[model samples]
Target: MSREPTRAAILIRESRKRAGLTQQALAEKLGITTSAVCNYESGASFPKAEMVFGLCDILDLTPRDLFECE
Candidate 1:
């Protein structure tokens, strides 16, 4: 089934862009595969808690920013 992108997906994608990092670059920083980043951005899967923190750090954002999409 086609799934709409989740809030987390939008947050990750926007934050990554704000940080000026491409999916490949973000994946390298997160030590994950590019497809993993794509999957998260596409809302095909959710990131683990640790990954959330990692994203916060790499994206120069807070958990609140990532979670609340503010």
Candidate 2:
């Protein structure tokens, strides 16, 4: 596996922080479990396409933001 972080993980973490949202809070907003949020942030799992849009809306990020690597 690659050692580098996934863009989804980085974007989710940074955007969540910037929005002052905890995993629980974000999960609540998305109607998902906190563990799901954690998985996404840790790159252990990825959201579905529809969920991606939902996350972007809730986290104030664009689709590009989640795919862009720094």
Candidate 3:
């Protein structure tokens, strides 16, 4: 993967941290594998479109933080 992190990945990682959650904890809550959480945080892959909204709620991030705003 590229060295640069995706904006959404960075935001996810930051928000998870801000929420005081570990990768495993977040994965458990999201019903995903810890490795999958790692991939998302590392920007190895992107979360699905439907998942973004769930992530925003779980991580307490605004959609504007994970995505572009007009």
Candidate 4:
């Protein structure tokens, strides 16, 4: 069965695509390993709350937009 897409995963995917960024590039911006970014995208794990905000800053996305929340 297919799992539902997570907000974080969707946001990360969209932001990276919009920026024309590879996981390695975004990982560099986050000061994290590329493997971590890969894992997050693969839904192997998730970032912390602070990292969520950090991702928003790096990705030029508002938290509401990133989460697609009302």
Q: Please report the candidate that would top TM-score against the real structure.
A: 1
Whole-model Cα lDDT of every candidate shown, in order? 0.87, 0.86, 0.82, 0.76
Task: Tell me the tens digit of each residue's lDDT in model 4 across 5-27.
Answer: 57677777778889888999988
TM-score of each: 0.85, 0.84, 0.84, 0.73
In terms of lDDT, model 1 sits at 0.87
Tell me the spans in candidate 4 whose CA falls farther than 4 Å from its real position.
1-5, 66-70
Tens-digit per-residue lDDT, 4-66, candidate 1: 898878888998999999999999999999999999999998778788889888888788766
Between candidates 1 and 3, name the one with more favorable lDDT.
1
Candidate numbers sorted by lDDT from highest down: 1, 2, 3, 4
- Per-residue alpha-carbon lDDT of candidate 2 for residues 1-70, written as tens digits (9 for 90 to 100): 7455587798899999999999999999999999999889888888887898999998888877876743
Clashes of each: 0, 0, 0, 0
Stretches off by above 4 angstroms in model 2 are 1-4
- Model 1, which residues run further than 4 Å from truth? 68-70
Q: Work out candidate 2's RMSD over C-alphas.
A: 2.5
Report how far off residue 17 is in candidate 4 (Å): 1.2
- Clashing residue pairs in candidate 4 (N, C-alpha, C atoms within 3 angstroms): none
The predicted structure with the larger lDDT, 3 or 4, is 3
